[model samples]
Target: MEAVFSKEIQSGLDQARVASMKKSSRLRVCADGKKQTVLRMWKTGFAMEADAPDMRGMVDLYDGSIHLFRCLVVTTAEESGERHYEFKRATAVRGTPALDFETPEHAPAGLIEDAR
Candidate 1:
């Protein structure tokens, strides 16, 4: 027999599940140009839906829309039945725009590397 829960009971359970979860993050995964929602995440690893792309090895992590990291990862089917990925290496990426202003010719020379 199928059991049903009242709206209030269901809502309570939903709220409980959310409350029991780790701190929510805007983190997401992008691989082979396909983006997938991050189901769960941790310092060393993260999980995406099991139906996510079979592509693995290298993945780019994003916070909502901003690029955050490049990770070398390996996949495993966790006991929880989720497609889990463990990070073998994670490197932070930063966007640095070229300096818009150029030093005046009168400015004292800094270094040969700076001229390059």
Candidate 2:
């Protein structure tokens, strides 16, 4: 998985969801700022066409609503030269921020843990 700060999605999200475009985007890092990379963030919400229903004569017409978020982080040693870019999808629940990005699938456990 790569953490890509998708510029296209970010711009589109900023216009559609005005409140979520925060100014700061820094990676979680060690005390010396030498171990991690954090990139910009873009959050948006959209819907996709749903697949057909199961047997029994019911068909789902919509894929339900989904939230999309992208982030750009530098590649870790584990990832080799590839940059870290991410895209997350989550369901929209009541009272939840509609455009918040989901957690990274492979974030480092911690400084000491990652060092191992």
Candidate 3:
């Protein structure tokens, strides 16, 4: 789907250091099942590699305008241990069209390479 609003965050030093960077976007998706008022959040990240930067992205879905409230959190896993979480600006948007599976043209350059 096309992003109504998008933002990205980069951390660390060089590409290696910036490997843990994140990118987030706000988009509208179809609603299924009963409850119309629903909110969903999900995260995606890369695998760690020797001397490679690890990156991740978080996606949140709700009903309303875009770019509303955003925050980060730290949590511990009972089995895996502690983990760091980061998010983009608070964003909410309404309306839905057929899911656009096409890659966004406005995506940052070298995003794929940097994730490697």
Candidate 4:
């Protein structure tokens, strides 16, 4: 997919400066088509969320490099007061440095422990 950082995303990153100052990693934003997605990543784990006209409540989580373990959740509105939820799991190549997946001792908190 094609993605690019946009002005609105830059503004959000600017606002996240406070968090970065507090020792939290700065968040990154990229636009895929008309949708904007935010990604907050640290050494241990990362979280991504997206909301747009065609998509809403999209989330993805990963531990470490994000190529080994992943959990995705997509929520779509069906009708009045109704919503559809879809969940997916995948193991894909990210072309990043390989990580030792045998140990979870340093795994980030709030990650889906059983995502595999």
Winner of 2 and 4 under TM-score: 4
RMSD of 3: 21.6
- Writing each residue's lDDT as its tens digit, candidate 3 over 12-114 gives 2333332333122222222232111211235621111233222233334333545323322222221111132334443433355456687698977664555
Give one clash count per candidate, in the order shown: 0, 8, 5, 0
| lDDT (10s digit) by residue, model 4, range 1-116 | 97677878865775465335324433322224231222343333333333223333333332332423333445443331123334443334366768776757877767566776
Q: List the residue pairs that clash in candidate 1.
A: none
Each candidate structure's TM-score, on Cα atoms with residue i matched to residue i, is 0.58, 0.16, 0.17, 0.21
Best by TM-score: 1
The full ranking of all candidates by lDDT, starting with the best, is 1, 4, 3, 2
Stretches of candidate 4 exceeding 4 Å from the true structure = 1-35, 39-51, 54-73, 76-86, 96-116
- Model 1 is weakest, by summed lDDT over 10 consecutive residues, at 14-23
Q: Which stretches of candidate 1 lie above 4 Å from their native place? A: 1-25, 97-116
lDDT values, one for every candidate: 0.74, 0.29, 0.31, 0.40
What are the C-alpha RMSDs, in order, of all predicted structures? 9.7, 22.4, 21.6, 16.7
Task: Give the local distance difference test score of model 1.
Answer: 0.74
Worst 10 residues of 2 by lDDT: 46-55
Displacement of residue 100 (Cα, Å) in model 4 is: 22
Q: What is the lDDT of residue 70 in candidate 4?
A: 34
- Global lDDT of model 4: 0.40
